[model samples]
Target chain A: MDGHGGRERQLFELGRLVKAGLTQPLGLMRPGGVGRILAVRSGEGDVERGLLEMGFVEGACVEVLHHGFLGRDPLAVRINQAMTVALRRGEANAVLVGPLLNRATDVEPTTDQESRPS
Target chain B: MTAGTLAAEGFRPARIALVGPPNSGKTTLFNTLTGGRQKTANYPGVTVERKSGLLKTPGGHPVEVLDLPGSYSLRARSPDEAITRDVVLGRQARETLPDALVCVTDATNLGQHLRLLLELRQLGRPLILVLNMMDIAQKRGCQISTEALSRQLGIPVVTTVAMRKHGVRDLLGQIDALLNQAPAGDGVTAISDWVEPSPDAIRAHHREVERLLQEAVVREGAPEHLTRQLDRVLLHPVAGPLILLALLFLMFQAVFSWAEAPMDWIDGGMAGLQQWLSAHMEESLLKSLLVDGIVAGVGGVVIFLPQILILFLFILLLEDSGYMTRAAFLMDRLMSAVGLNGRAFIPLLSSFACAIPGIMAARTIAHPLDRLVTILIAPLMTCSARLPVYVLLIAAFVPATTVWGGIGLQGLVMFGLYATGIVGALAVAGVLRLTLLRGDRQPLLMELPSYKWPNPANVLLGLWERAKIFMRRIGTIILSVLVILWFLSTFPAAPEGATEPAIYYSFAGLIGRTLEPLLAPIGFNWQIAIALVPGLAAREVAVAALGTVYALSGDEGAVTEALTTTLAQSWTLATALSLLAWYVFAPQCLATLAAVRRETNSWRWAAFMFVYLMTLAYLAAFVTYRVALALGGG
Candidate 1:
């Protein structure tokens, strides 16, 4: 799972939208960046099992949707095109995602104007 | 395989289990298949719901169907999920091994659902895969080849829209086919090859699911654009919480406003029936039992049905609309700060209507400690039962004058009483979380289901189920308690010539006076003491008990008004305030205690709850009485 960390470090060294691996807290991500999951290591109990069951798996694409208003503790992340999982930053920290591909065409736009009916 | 062949072999109902991931439309399909002929109970000792229905085949053979609680895998983490695993593997002694399994999966999210299907397939049962919610999937432009999927998995596949009438017939036909063909192997023997799911095994299952989806399912446009658009507002940092609050406010307001006429209808109807019976029947124990005991006691409870239905309607809508998860997401931060899981929010909120269903709902929380704390604090919410008492006291004592831009003072006091209950629950949960039940906080990792309009038929079915449960409680526990209370208050017959009404000389009054010294510190007289005894059966019984006590004193000029006026003339302001404070902490409801005992699977926790709540009630009442006296309200 840490394989993505080294690759992410190289991208970070190149000084682009890339930062640390998805294993880092979701709070560390740029608000609109898109990434693919490398692993989900969120402890060993129902919590991790539930997260995995909800599609937090390797090779599935994920994008940080937004943070909650209070303390920004829980971060909403959209996985695949079918599910949105609301997770705490602490929980999201264990779910590893690869470095961002691009912001424009990858992540679903956070603004309602794009998805709203014209 | 025809019915005649089965009859020749001596037919028995084939037990088919409906298993699925949550939100996969399992219950809808079950309801459609069974057509409201379902029976629900608890799994013997545990509180996990057991729902089974008899489905009649087209040829008149019966198929017994059990709706197992939704689970992600055979690997069990929660008690609810454990029941599913045990029953499926035939490990439960009391449960019959299912002859076949109907593994339901979501048509929209086959990736996750297929993993569980694959896991169940290895159990070697005669399994039929159902791709439910086909209409929604097709609307989202996803195409699934059911035949190809069936061929790959070696099981019959059925496509269903669950909510529509015609969509379930194909699934029923498929079930018929599976049951007609005797299952391939003895299901119990296959357990030997079954491996417990491990983290690595799970990842492998996911890999296989991905590979399978690649060949069997195809998608067109954006899959969740509608969900995202709605969540952009419903889950907005500012707008989300605001909308949730508005919805809750509207719900409470509707509970009071919308149900007024129906409640009045029930009340008037019961009153007229009681009067006609009393006049027509001879003056005997049977008449008294029918009139005062059954009519007054149970009738008071039955009147609240309209409000209960309304409250449950809103709950059903919120659940069916798929916004419950979003509400959980919205409340996660606030709830975790007080040591509760976000999922506990709905159960605790439900407690505001009634604690029995609220505690039952707590089973959905996976973590044991969180579930325990949620159950412990649930009774602290001011249920609709408390409303009668609050309204009575507020109307009789607090002025009805408008204040703060036209809000009635009575309304303000009602709101204050509700706020006090919430504050008390939060304090107790925080204290318990820090002390006896202290543990690490569980992570909030919940799925937000795709939004959909609340299905009316599904909502109505859910409400009907709730109504049945409520009526069952009334028929059994509440009825028996009321009968016993009547005997205590009615017997030893009012000493033919005695002055102060019959109840004064009866067993109940004697017991009340005997217990008065213990209660006097809280400023309660023997009348209040008498009412408190039967209030143990249910908190709202206190109101009826007071009415009975007053009426027996020969002041029965229309029970409700007379009781209120008498209380105002007799009790001091300090006493009334103290009584309200006492009720705020009262562990008096026997039904809640019974539910707690059942849910926790121990008499010890139930006893612990009773003791702690009684002590709190006493202390709070004592302090309130003293403070009220000091403030010159005496």
Candidate 2:
């Protein structure tokens, strides 16, 4: 929080400051890393809505399961510990990931635990 | 409540619709419910499949069930989704609205499936919730309370394992109960007024769904270990592509080796029938038409059925095992390099079976230009219809020898022809992206469902469906085309004292001679010129037409000889090779152009497809003929 002014925190602090860029795009996360979805920005068409509809909402937990063979462009990400979706880096750019509020193991599916919105 | 309130006690509904998100096991449940008693039709004005079945309830009441296309939401983006949206809203022409809706959800992956369930609930129709695949969910140590789910949604809920036929009877009984409890006019609400929900509205809906899930479902996240373990190797960058190519190689090899016995039996049967007809009937036009035109023409195409069914069997198995999407994931990088994403790969792969459905499958691509480009190049996938023509040419021309360390030469030639089609498709796509239909690439986003074992019953049913479609094509279009060709070759007999065969003085010969000059440079004789005319109707008919044309040309008893042997003795190596090259890029069957027109909603693109393919065909044939002649192959 060096340059940032006093402001309320989001869901969880950037999931332990990642190496290679502080706040990374969901697409950039390597496999086995967990991050909290901070925001999903809109692109040309229904890019934003499509991401949100697929469970990439704010405060959701996401883990990268695997990356495609070539160029590692498309990544398979497990979201909310419930559904696994594959998306290209371009589409994953709409989802911004910050530090995980809790440890990766603490992440459970939305149905198993209740973390009601304030 | 409007008019049937007095009669609501025992009133029953007439029609019901089953709808759900893709991979929700919706189709499987439908298949189990209908038990092969379903019929497939096209929605009026569109090619989307309209599947309907008759379900007779235990109470002796007959209910018509319609299986709508799988969709994620009512906010439609593609033609498939649009059809689902239109029918549910009672706005589609020639489609009657169902009185009730049965929504299916995958119990194992209810996280996203429930969101779709929430969307369908907004329509205010008489709805029931089907929690399918409960067996796998239970295996993963999950518990879903159907009663609580029913209470939360104010709808009846049923759990089922549709795969092994468990809990289906209760679901059927539940449907019967719903029909009787509903009043005649109960479900007819203002469902037609639905519109696309805003992003904020959808987010709110998701929150509501999360709340509902917490109350009715309870379990720790049971990740699919099988999927994770398999993907480790299957998607292992290097091993992934190797396995994919190896699988493709095995498929092509099996198609050749496994089909020999069945093909021979069909061949022998055709020959015996021809001999019997010629021996019993007098030498007249009727006998000639039956033995020469009908039997020979239809027989040539029927021998390829074993090969076609083998090709479809591999496709069905891959799709069922959830490997198709993984293959698409592997293809994304190359596809994106050509201004397309991996989303277009599935349709292009499906094109290898037939281009009509492949073009129709392109609706999933949200970008209009990408969809158009995918549809245009789909015909280059070398569909099964072209197998007859390719096998005929190779059998007649190429020697039955091995190459490259024990690989069969004929199979190698067949493999080369398929490769040519693929290379031509990629080159055309690159050129189109550079010239026309240019647009920003839409990133691929697709669901990779959990891997499941391929159900044997489903695979068998799929194979049966494909076999029927192939036979129907021959019985209808191929038979009609041959009959016309026979009449043209028969009438206006040779003048007295003429030394040539009678067919030489007929209408078909005159027409073939007229077109011979244009095709002569490509090594196509007058006989091939005749076959090429009706070949436009269907690619397989080219082989059948050749069988008919040559049967009438040779001396008596020549019609009984196999077409393959007849062709081998008459055509040169250069001519055979040139024709194979022509087919690799030649114009597709007429139905393919019609499909392109319907999908693109314009004739300009269809005409463009015809012209470009014809140009490529002529150029390819010309070069092959010249090169083979120079190599001293004649």
Cα lDDT tens digits, model 1, B220-314, are 32366778779889888999999999999999999999999998888888888888987899999999999888887788788878988999999
TM-score of chain B of 1: 0.95
User: Could you tell me which 10 consecutive residues in candidate 2 chain B have the lowest summed lDDT?
Assistant: B1-10
Give the DockQ (C-alpha) for candidate 1: 0.36
lDDT for each residue of candidate 2 in B516-576, tens digit (9 for 90 to 100): 9999999999888877876766787677567666654432224334777888999999999
Clashing pairs in 1: A22-A97
User: C-alpha displacement of B614 in model 1, angstroms?
Assistant: 1.2
Candidate with the greatest lDDT versus the true structure = 1
How many clashes in each candidate? 1, 4
Candidate DockQ scores, in order: 0.36, 0.37
Give model 1's docking category.
Answer: acceptable
